[model samples]
Target: MGVGRILLNILVVLAAIAGGFYQLKLKPILVKFGQGRVIDPRGNTDCTTVPELKACEKLVLHQPSGVVYLACSTQESRPHWLPNAQRFNATGASRTDYVASYNPQSGKVTKLKTVNFNSPRGLSLHGMDVVASSSNPSELWVYLVNHREPLSGDPKVVGADSSVEVFKTTLGGSTMEYVRTVEDPLLLTPNDLTGTPDGKAFWVTNDYGVKTGLIRDLDLLGRATTSVVYCHETEGCKYAIQNMHGNNGIAQAPNGTFYVVNAIGGQLTVLEKQADNTLIITDVIESDRSMDNASIDSEGDVWVAGFPKALVLVYEHFANPTKVVSPSTAFRFSINTGPNSFYGQKFKVDRVCDRSSYTLSVACHRIT
Candidate 1:
């Protein structure tokens, strides 16, 4: 064959291969990842961005007092040391992160002051839960995920020495008393948690089995190495559910059922607690967009914060949150009691809040 003809044939073969790969592999995956998805702004247009609550990740709403608790940090610090985001520059991480309460009715915001919390590395806050005391009406238990930088190791190499910290505070009060820090080897890469009312035990999500390096990033490609750990003061910690695909935020219903949302795969795994305190998967609900954290309401509905555009969130927003704003949405998953319930619809998923413009930034990292 002539040299020109041979080169042309080679180009044709490469083009055919690329076209097949795009159609078979990349297209389906990107569609599942929420690429080119536009959220409708009809009944879901009631969301307003609170300027005071920037980078507040997880939120727990107190049904009695109508106060919302938030685990917050600055946007600048999040791109530096969020372990889930895989940005591990600990030197730039915020050490003075805080928990704040916002009253929707009164339009008041209070930063709960820490008392007797003397950790040298301070609080690199992430996921959190606010549980009311079983015995006292005025008392509340705050479980916070503190991604504390290791004291004597490179954070990029060793990852955060993550643990769940328990704090005691009064309802609507501005101070939180440091109770104790719960640390276990199983507490690796702790993300979000749901705590017991007695403040003695909790179940936390390990978003990754391995702490640092390439293995941790395997979750991006649909790996199932994350898990949930049941931690108690005396019993230590153990895995409640292992080999979870994308464990992120977890919330417990009043009836003891747990709802866990995934970050990359966007699966909501519903779990039921067993007799031995471990959890078993009861059902799995799928979402069109990737989700970060989840919260249970007073009426037993699960509210999840979802990322509408995965590419913008992963590439643009996290890289420069202040400059670029990614689209966001709020999903409510509840028991299907409508007419569709008879048609084998066990649950109803609704997009309660949708913000597609730059005004509302609701990426996977922060919600509320």
Candidate 2:
């Protein structure tokens, strides 16, 4: 070998010897690498099988806390999967409409609180809190469940319908106030929902109980508007929707395309806004059976977390899926949802109408 080559080989050998010594006497250096890991496609997580979850419904990841809070339906209460579980006897909920929170970073739970829900169903995680929809009290009603842990079990009031109560979150604590309810144009006997990541609007859908079709629209300021599509109805444009899972769980793609799940429709549908800015379902993701609520990661790998037989299913692309099954799959759920936090920025800013809320005028001195 040439002198340089000999020197390089000697250096490598020396590094190995030194590394060994350092590992024994000093801090050891560790390196992490990624690989292709195989997972089972058919695993079940349910009260009957996994015995951890009583029933899994809406699931979501709260980025700030690095946790996954799932709304579950149980025969009696939130199951043994969590230690400190909370239960709300939603006077209208079937004893299964309680909320549960878990930390994905540590794979442990921090808090589990229940909202007194009547007909409580769909659940989603927002910022650091939880939003649960229930008609326990009224028709135009939806309740926002906060992250607060109460002192003890709060008995669910019987025959109570407090859906008109609205909620907002602050750094200090959770606040519940009343907001005017808009008429239910969609006739939402709601199934699933997802608010736009931009925090501008939200989408809710009912699983087509009537031929009127599954509900779809934007919730802006408590005002619900059925998407106006036909150009003749608007300015002479015909609108069509495709790529829908038929309203299983409304999930936003990492790049903003929306995917629909049927949960039992046995299909994962995808929807996109047209170039003309009208909405349409364009594609459907399929498997041996219907898929439920799904979450997409930065790599565009879609994770369908759900049940009958519970599974954490993965796909290579939204349109095409290469099945990935996690070993922990084995739960039966009615509905499921989750998110993969890659990296980005999340913030809430104060808005001021005027340019100079506080003026800063600098005094300058002339220097020669």
Candidate 3:
């Protein structure tokens, strides 16, 4: 072995070590970090008028007072590196996700307390009581499929199973307090929920089963194997309707009729309560856009949040988190009950809000 041969051997050894480190360690870490990264698109558009409206996931209105409460998840804010890493930050902390209250008369929004749970997606309120579904992954064991601990802290402190949070608002609509959290095995992907008039029992929509990756995507594109569960204080949660296609929002009318939106099917199903407390499908109304949550106004009309463009807004949000703008519309429909049949009348569809944001729930001010 001469000097040149020895040098060549040394070079080969060093190159082999570098290749192993890159292939085995560095690549996996990069892929894991990339999963949590968000790429926001850059652009600007001024459509604040009628054609374009602000995006909101859930909206609840105080009937007599006309105070509108909105749950704006700001899902785009979730994927950024620093915020994703820290569940709680001491310095320059990120804005907490909150339920915002909009005064229809004054046009002023008062943001309530930041929700304790992550990913506050859907919201429903009756009188001063409110219920919402939190779909945070660490909050739910289901999200562990692609779980990556926020880069900086002990993963244990930041992650837990998901649940539904209940709250009560003051009559003045100035404040709210956390009442209790509902964790049930039946609540596998709880999306939107509606409370009873008395605020005792509630109904929730599970968007999908315990699934992820391509299977979940395919299930959504096809008919979703989701269901709606009725949750009670003593009896716990039970299945109300099964095998729904993208079950989303749910609302109950004053007459005890239930209205549910099948997001993928683009239709609203009207359910009537039987003597045994089970619900019977009374009617189904076709919709032009993907329907989300439904709220019954004082006049027995149902107000729904409509996603006109399907999942284009969702793709845009993932591609360009910041610059993505999606259109949102609200529709008002009337339900006429006959002795033998049920009829639905489309009163009007209003382009209330727009932008890159999505609206989840809708409610009208009713003095109940």
lDDT of 1 at 132: 93
Expressed as tens digits, the lDDT of each residue in 134-208 for candidate 3 is 332111110001112233543334331335566655534555555555767786666677775443467777776
Ranking by TM-score: 1, 3, 2
Off by over 4 Å in 2: 1-53, 77-96, 105-166, 170-183, 197-200, 211-246, 274-278, 306-368
Per-residue lDDT of model 1, residues 229-313, tens digit only:
9999898899998998889889888887998888787778999999888899999998887888887766777888877787888
Which parts of model 3 are misplaced by more than 4 Å?
Answer: 1-55, 78-95, 114-160, 318-321, 336-368
Estimated TM-score for each candidate: 0.91, 0.42, 0.63
For candidate 3, give the lDDT of residue 77: 42
Residue 62 deviation, candidate 1, in Å?
0.3
Between candidates 2 and 3, which one is better according to TM-score? 3
For candidate 3, report its TM-score: 0.63
What are the per-model C-alpha RMSD values against the true structure? Answer: 3.3, 22.5, 13.8
Model 1, residue 177: distance off in Å is: 0.1
Q: How many clashing pairs in candidate 3?
A: 13
lDDT of 1 at 181: 97
